[model samples]
Target: MINICFKQSSSKILGFNIEGHAEYGEEGEDIVCSAVSALSYTIVNGITEVLKISVEHIIKDGFLQLSLRDNNLEEIEKCQVLLETMLLGFKSMEIGYGDYIKVQVEEV
Candidate 1:
């Protein structure tokens, strides 16, 4: 299963941690995993390249973690839309593939 946890402070998103694989199909044909990866990379690129915000991230097999490098509320706010969109995508996936994915939100 793919486990995703979003961390927030004062109702603002701070970052997220995602680990595991859907294992719903053969590696290359796992649509769940592919969707997750595409959304993740899009948000990462949107924040780091488009928004020009510094971020701390770790990418590895079946794992991806990302956090705003600075805690500045304004900077963090800039990422909300993209992050929230990612959340929506994940939630939608969970609805369809509950057996393969889990989503959680945590107050930090």
Candidate 2:
């Protein structure tokens, strides 16, 4: 299952931790996983490449984690929209694949 967790600092969403994979089918043929991978990679690439924001991240087989390198709200504000939209996409995915994906919000 893919677990998407949004971290909150005070009332604002700081960043997120996305880990695991939704083993719904064979790796290459899983549409659910495809959608998620596309969206997740897009956001991560956008933030670090297009948006040129420094980020802390980790990646391994079946897992990926990402966070802003700096915690200052001002620094985060630079990519706030992208981060929130990423979570929104993840939540939408959960609506359809709740059995294989989990979405949660946590205070950090």
Candidate topping TM-score: 1
Q: Tell me how far candidate 2 lies from the true structure as C-alpha RMSD in angstroms.
A: 1.5
Question: How does each model score on TM-score?
Answer: 0.96, 0.89
Highest lDDT, which number?
A: 1
Tens digit per residue, CA lDDT, model 1, 1-108: 999999988777899999999999998999999999999999999999999988899999999999874658888999999999999999999999999999999998
lDDT of 2 by residue, 1-108 (tens): 888888877667767777787889998998878888889789889888997877888777777788763656676887778878888888888898898889999988
Pairs that collide in candidate 1 are none
lDDT (C-alpha) at residue 76 in model 2: 81
Clashes of each: 0, 0
Q: State the displacement of the C-alpha of residue 71, model 2, in Å, after optimal TM-score superposition.
A: 4.5
Q: How far is candidate 1 from the true structure (C-alpha RMSD, Å)?
A: 0.9
- Candidate 2: pairs in clash: none
